[model samples]
Target: MELVPFKDTGKAPAQNFTGDVYVTSIKTPTEPSRLTAALVRFTPGARTNWHSHALGQTLHVTEGVGYVGTRDGKVIRMRAGDTVWTPPGEEHWHGGTATTFMCHIAMLEASAEGDPTTWLEPVTDETYQSAGN
Candidate 1:
């Protein structure tokens, strides 16, 4: 195995997130593989739009408080050591709390057709308001 160089991809665009968000690539599909991973950092109140991974996705929280929610309105409160797994094609969104910056290691595998994630509409204010810190 070789060391994969880390790349700072910079802040996620507002179109894909509600507030300031950043990502650092830890690993990418090297070839003949679909595995990819990144360290994602979210500013307070920042969050991803509704999305899902093709194979599944694993999130390991690295710092501060974060929130992950599903369509059915089940919001999971996560801390620095928390780990969460979202099954394949299960639409969801995650982000930092209103008052805290958060960071997590996001790991997922792309499908054979080179599809890794499917992005849906942004989480509405009505939906996000229902979440708990």
Candidate 2:
């Protein structure tokens, strides 16, 4: 057994996200564990760029309100204690609501080559604000 000390990774790059975002690596893949987990926090209106996981991803909301936007014009609102699952290879983005800060524990499995995610273009206002914007 071992303890993983807390570390602040700082603001997420604007190229990959919008607004203020921070992440704390929780657990990374190892020889015996392929699970990758992180604590992701977002300030009001902050969000991730479109991305997908090789083995899908699970998000367990821990604070505030947010929205999970999918490529098919779906924007699902989320709140603390709520959980959502994104299927493998499905393009999507998650973020805090316009008026609230939000945080979630994101979990996914590393791929065979240890690459777990593929990030794509940023979600545009036409697709992120709402189903049809």
Clashing pairs in 1: none
Q: What does candidate 1's lDDT look like per residue over 1-133, in tens digits?
A: 7776657678887877888999988878867777898999999988999999999999999999989999988999899999999999999999998889999999999788787899888998778767863
Model 2, 1-133: lDDT tens digits are 8787787687777889988999988888887789989899999878999999999999999999999988787778999999999999999999998789999999999988668889899877666566323
RMSD of 1: 1.3
Off by over 4 Å in 2: 131-133
Q: Top TM-score: which candidate number?
A: 1
Candidate number of the best lDDT:
1
Model 1 worst lDDT window (10 residues): 1-10
The local lDDT score (0 to 100) that residue 113 gets in candidate 1 is 77
How does each model score on TM-score? 0.94, 0.92
